[model samples]
Target: MPTLAEQLQTALRQETAVAQRLYEVMAQEQSALQRMDSASIQALAQEKSRLLAALDQQLLARQKLVPNHQVEGAVDALINTFPAAIANPLQQAVDQLRELLFRCHNQNEINGRIISASRRSVERSLSLIRGHQPDAVLYTQNGGATRMGPNRRFASA
Candidate 1:
């Protein structure tokens, strides 16, 4: 029985909460990456996914409450048309959510890069364990395949 603006404000507040949690998780994930803690990273990733799903639900709920949800400038239109008190609080929530989500994205990107680097290092280590240097391609001078390098024998294990 709440007004549309009130519903939207509530949804936006919920969205902001999810975004804030996601941002914290991403920050913790970055720390886990630095510490090379795969278990913590996995746990944080699951939590982040849950927060994202909740945020998506909040967005859909907000969209459903707004009449001009599909319009390009619906948010701006809504803000300009609503009362100052409602509009101001909703706008602040939206702004804070935007900034928190941005931070989450940036941190997630950096964590992805760190994970990629770690994977590469692990791959190199595995390659060495298997007696194959990553850069040492087994090929002859005439483009023929030949194992003429000092590499480990994987079959000997």
Candidate 2:
């Protein structure tokens, strides 16, 4: 069996890899959203979900190696319990994993914003097609400002 430090190190490395992949997938998802590619976005979303689950599992495994896993800074406390030779490298791995997870989180947020913007645009278009004028001022085909009565109908069955 591997030592506790070694197991934790391996878990961190696996989690880091998953986080790195997640960041890349989120970047691709952003591009898909920009291009309005529904298929690719759907596939990438599934992949992202899988990666997140895997990362969670790896985290749980790593936590099991720490005696005080429920306590704040428990991993750091465990790292300090080891000799410098083992502890330094383990700490470095932890830092790298932390940075990758942070990047993944930021990228996910960016993707969410893109999705929100797209949804708003779609809703606005649908509202126009359904004859529901938005509260904002409107423009006519002649490039002049115009406003329609609230009861005006743009389409009918």
Candidate 3:
């Protein structure tokens, strides 16, 4: 059987690799959003889910080995549990993984906003085509809602 330190190293490596892959996937997703490629974005989302599952599994394995399963806490646990020789490298690996995962989060947030904006734009266009103003809401004197009139702008164009 491999030593605990060795196991920790292997797990760290696996987690780091998965984190890097996730970052790459997020980057590709950003591109797909920019290009408005629905199919590519769908495929990328599925791939990201799979990678996330794998990362979860890695975290489970790390939990079995370390007291603290969280990336930041796990590094400290590894340093306290193992020798300096093993702990130093593990710390670096874990730190890098954490950084990469953080980048993935930031990129995903940006992509999400872009997707939300695109969805709103599409909904507005559809509403206009259906003879309704998406952004215009009129209320009666008593604060009752009124039915929307046909959006004549589209007809005149």
Candidate 4:
């Protein structure tokens, strides 16, 4: 049986993994948005929704372990590391994003600021669609069919 401390630590670590995976998936979805098609966007939207939901659930579970979990590593370190810590699984989770940010842009390392900046970049791009083209149109690859909906169209080009 895992001690409470160990169990909590494991849970905390898992939260970090969940956040990174979510970020990666969101990034991919954002890139896919460029195709200007409904089906792809729609699928991405669905996947994003699912990922967000799972993240939410994981967050809730993490919270249950948060109050007493910081025996060796901190729970907040994993969740709030944002820009200063190891958004990557291989790094040590830090306390603040500023520490990560100080690593310099060219540092190309896992720190709070750098991680936060990258996350913000992905977020900004995702926000672009929501801002400029909330109601943009999309066409399919072969230009065979065209459908109109929120992020769900694939018309033949």
- For 25-133, candidate 4 gives per-residue lDDT tens digits of 5555545544445587578668767766876676677667565554545554544543433344323433222242332222323333444676677776775545433
What C-alpha lDDT values do all the predictions have? 0.83, 0.88, 0.83, 0.52
Q: How far is candidate 4 from the true structure (C-alpha RMSD, Å)?
A: 15.0
Candidate 3 C-alpha lDDT tens digits along 12-88: 89988998999999999999999999999999999999999999999888778886556666558656777778778
Collision pairs in model 2: none
Off by over 4 Å in 3: 68-74, 134-157
Residue 113 displacement (Å), model 2: 0.4
- CA shift of 138, model 4, Å: 30
Per-residue error (Å), model 2, residue 156: 7.0
Top of the candidates by TM-score: 2
Clashes of each: 1, 0, 0, 22
Name the lDDT of candidate 1.
Answer: 0.83
**Each model's TM-score?**
0.79, 0.88, 0.81, 0.44
Model 1 per-residue lDDT at 90: 82
Please list the residue runs of candidate 1 whose C-alpha ends up more than 4 Å from where it truly belongs after superposition: 134-157
In model 4, what lDDT does residue 68 have? 51
> Arrange candidates by lDDT, highest first: which order?
2, 3, 1, 4
